[model samples]
Target: MIGNMEIFLIILAALILFGPDRLPKIARELGRAIREFRNSLEEDLAG
Candidate 1:
């Protein structure tokens, strides 16, 4: 499992790489992708 410091470093790297303006947009897309992936997994398990 990742520690808080590790997570913070990852976020810091992402901010530097993607910049502040695009980070939120990227996060939103990532969230949507995760949600869709979870939904598909649930449907598959239910079916």
Candidate 2:
């Protein structure tokens, strides 16, 4: 299980790697990928 410190470290690392300029774009793409994955799972379950 990850704690708050772990989450913070991950975010810090991401900031260092991607920088502030591209973080929002990366986050938006990640969110869309997750949303699409969930939608596909729901469709599979319902069908």
Best by lDDT: 1
lDDT of each: 0.99, 0.98
RMSD of 1: 0.6
lDDT of 2 by residue, 1-47 (tens): 99999999999999999999999999999999999999999999999
**Alpha carbon lDDT at 18, candidate 1:** 100
Q: Compared with the true structure, what per-residue lDDT tens digits does model 1 show for residues 5-45?
A: 99999999999999999999999999999999999999999
Model 2 CA lDDT for position 12: 97
Candidate 2 lDDT: 0.98
RMSD of each: 0.6, 0.9
Candidate 1: where is the Cα deviation over 4 Å?
A: none
